[model samples]
Target: MSGFASWIGGALGWTLGGPIGAAIGFAIGAAVDKATSKGLLLEPPKRGSQQRRKRVDPVYEKRRRRKTVREKQAQTKSGDFEVSLLVLSAIVMKVDGEVSESEKDFVRNYFTKMYGKQRANHAFKLFNGLLKKEDISTRQICQQIQMYMDHSSRLQLLHYLFGVTKADGHVDESEVDLIEKIAGYLYINDRDFQSIKAMFYNPVDSAYKILEIDKSATNNEIKKAYRKMAKKFHPDKLEHLGEEHMKGANEKFQKVQKAYEQLQKERGF
Candidate 1:
């Protein structure tokens, strides 16, 4: 835990406060509880809580306090995105009552592909602790994300969540409702939400939904919507996160292309 605390300084400069901090700290404490029960939390717990916060680093605290508001919300680190994904994934995995092996494997494969074995193992450990947690507030977590994360990253969060729910072969209504609620809290509008949500489902009209267009729209409208949607889901939008992270964004981008081609074939324009 000592080494982990030092690492947190750079990795989680902005996410180390608010409900997201509490949730991550609590999950770590839960996973840590098995090995030892007397360590301090990542952040302060409630007034009457059994756990306590470790002593603050005087120099670090002073420096943090001096940071300007703009500096605090600085670029969202890749670590921030991974931690946020862990917390949100924990919430969605438990939404349908049972946490199946497939969902676990989905998460495992996801991080393993993006971050390799060690990090994926660490993520699953944290995710397991979060599942055992009972008081997670989806709204509060999303609100915290809204305050710090960029729209492209937030949209990626939504994309992975929909995939998680469907990992077990079918997405339950309850799961959809929870993911949709998370989207709304993250300030993702209805059309944008539907467009991403459509990537997983395979209904007759899914292509239109993926492009965020109505079935009744004109041929030119479909072309315009395709151009607009294509840019919105472009891989370059998330290039700041590095090339590895672009894979997921690219998946969404490809879906937009497929949807556009389908529309073009149908409309013959």
Candidate 2:
């Protein structure tokens, strides 16, 4: 009875526990055999148990995906703003054919006021760098501007460009031509453009009046009147309004140019 009990105890320990229990039983059997020449003890081995499976939390996975999407959106918006600012700056500088120091100063000052000093400086540097490329087309610049900037922002940028052209206190005919070309590229209509023109360039100036030529006016009087109107409606002096109002100025200036041109052609001057 005692031997059966010992055998059953050894089997239970080895099966329910692990290799350590089996080794301990074998050691005891070895010691007993050396003392009394008995056979070694044996027990059945236990089957290995499987490990517990890990669970994936759905909430954690969703949060990780959301974070990734937000990061991508931020990168896209940053790239777009940088490209838009660069193209707009280039168009403004090119409007007058030769970018004057006064124009550059005005751009710098305006941007510094609108954005911070550091951002303004960076934007100007980028614009200058882009302008150095000999093969770049104006259309390509406009396309980039269109891609990244909104409608209202583009209009505001156009206003700033006109402001730059007028920074020297005089708007040359070449400057007006350039502004018109840029406006066309921006898809601004003739009527709307004229509206902006009127806001900036007054058509009621004496030169326009001389173009109508009062019957009593002498040649000297006409010439003097032309000079006075030319100074006033030159497209550089009109101010104190937003770009939407400036559209009227543009229209007024176009009429002034046309009338002046017509008078010169008739007078053979």
Candidate 3:
């Protein structure tokens, strides 16, 4: 623990441990000294039957509430998308026996654009660290993602993995197998997996795959699928991920929109 953390633990009577502690410490900021002083200024509890619980400071309580809100906001701002991307990207790169230089360069540039050059290098180091591990569990990572991420987000995650595997213009069979296993762990439907897979590896019926619909589907069905996909891949949903991520989301959204337009034009609907 840093001096600030030590002082905070001692002063607030809080066991600084997890997310809550981090939030409170960040919220206290420069006001930590004042909060500590308030703690010190409290009257000591009397002995025996007269002993009472220490009075809670209203100001501190107010700050605590505010801290919770700030924590929620902070979580939203933190790059969940970016971190998840890196983790899965490592898996995609290493699935085929060895990580290729082209794949590494692709990931490095991707991270650099999302984060800065310094942070990108740090991310690459973390990627290398994961690769060094003897038993990296893809199932566990996918489980975590499936628990935290929405269905559409997971679909987008699969889409991104496909992008990484295809970065060198050829997707390895091992990479495809790994991605399919990841999709299974993520609880994604086979149809959904094939749908996203079609976009990158096979463009024969990409419009239907992009919209996640079928030729036998009615016009209303197509429209509904388009609306749902549009909402799912909307750039606005990625706004919390920063402008760079939003740009990527926008590109995905455009693909969905274009697919919808193509269907409409072809079907005269």
Candidate 4:
């Protein structure tokens, strides 16, 4: 149990149920077949009617394996973020008519940047299969995520989604509507939604939006907002999701910092 099987272990424990499981079943099966062929995962020989199933740590191998060097870290089923991303990416990419090459590249490049080429290839391959099924229910899939995923990871998911929506140069109105609805289903408040949304689509007051504050906010209010937003979007909040996910979390966190810095510079605070 290594490569793909290790990734599968997370789904087996968490997301391999309800709408999410139904949605990605084929893609996961296909990925398993490919991983098996690569000999990264060995199928144990069956004993009589009892099947031999190998059990691996639930996280994708990189994070779990790397964490072994550290002691007393919480480790358990972990692929919830990866699996959820695949389903949500398919939904976001396909929402605006056909999936654009730009959106595909955004996802592929992001995965490669975060997970390295080999694992990124595995993710994109599975994601392609998911894109084939265009009828995924966002509400149901989001419901599953909201119920099982931690709030910080959920925010990261929304951030990735907004990134996908903006990947094709311009964000479509339909995609915005759908993603907004998705935020609601994921239980994200409007302010948090706007904060993440502003990262991708910017206007004059975009920094204020990123801080979830209005233009008329007092200096003290702005300071509070900056501190609150900083805590909300901090990369450390997503540390449990592993180092790979920290890239996206850091992106959001930096936006919060930039927003704060802009306000600080403008008001001479």
Best by TM-score: 1
Model 4: residues with Cα > 4 Å off, grouped in runs: 1-7, 10-12, 28-78
Superpose all Cα atoms of candidate 3 onto the true structure and report the RMSD in Å to 1 decimal. 10.8
For candidate 2, the 10 contiguous residues with the lowest summed lDDT are 13-22
Q: Which stretch of 10 consecutive residues in model 3 shows the poorest summed lDDT? A: 13-22
Collision count for each candidate, in order: 0, 19, 0, 0
| Candidate scoring better on lDDT of 3 and 4 | 4
Q: What shift in Å separates residue 87 of candidate 3 from its native position after superposition? A: 1.9
Candidates ranked, most accurate by lDDT first: 1, 4, 3, 2
- Who wins the lDDT comparison? 1
All candidates' lDDT scores? Answer: 0.81, 0.50, 0.68, 0.78
Query: Per-residue lDDT for 1-269 in model 1, tens only?
Result: 53444333444546766787777677777433432233333453457767766899999987776564335445777778888888899999898899999998999999999988866777777778788999999899898888778888889999999989988897789999998899999999999999898888877899999988889999988889989998899999888777768999999999999998988888788
| Native-to-model Cα distance after best TM-score fit, residue 118 in candidate 2, in Å | 1.4
The residue pairs that clash in candidate 1, if any, are none
Ranking by TM-score: 1, 4, 3, 2
lDDT of 4 at 77: 28
Candidate 4 achieves a global lDDT of 0.78
Q: 24-93, model 2: which lDDT tens digit per residue?
A: 3333343323322333334334356476546868899789776764453333332233334444555556
- lDDT tens readout by residue for model 4, 149-186: 66777788899888888888887898889889989998
What is the overall TM-score of model 1 with all chains considered together? 0.83
Model 3 residue 93 lDDT score:
83
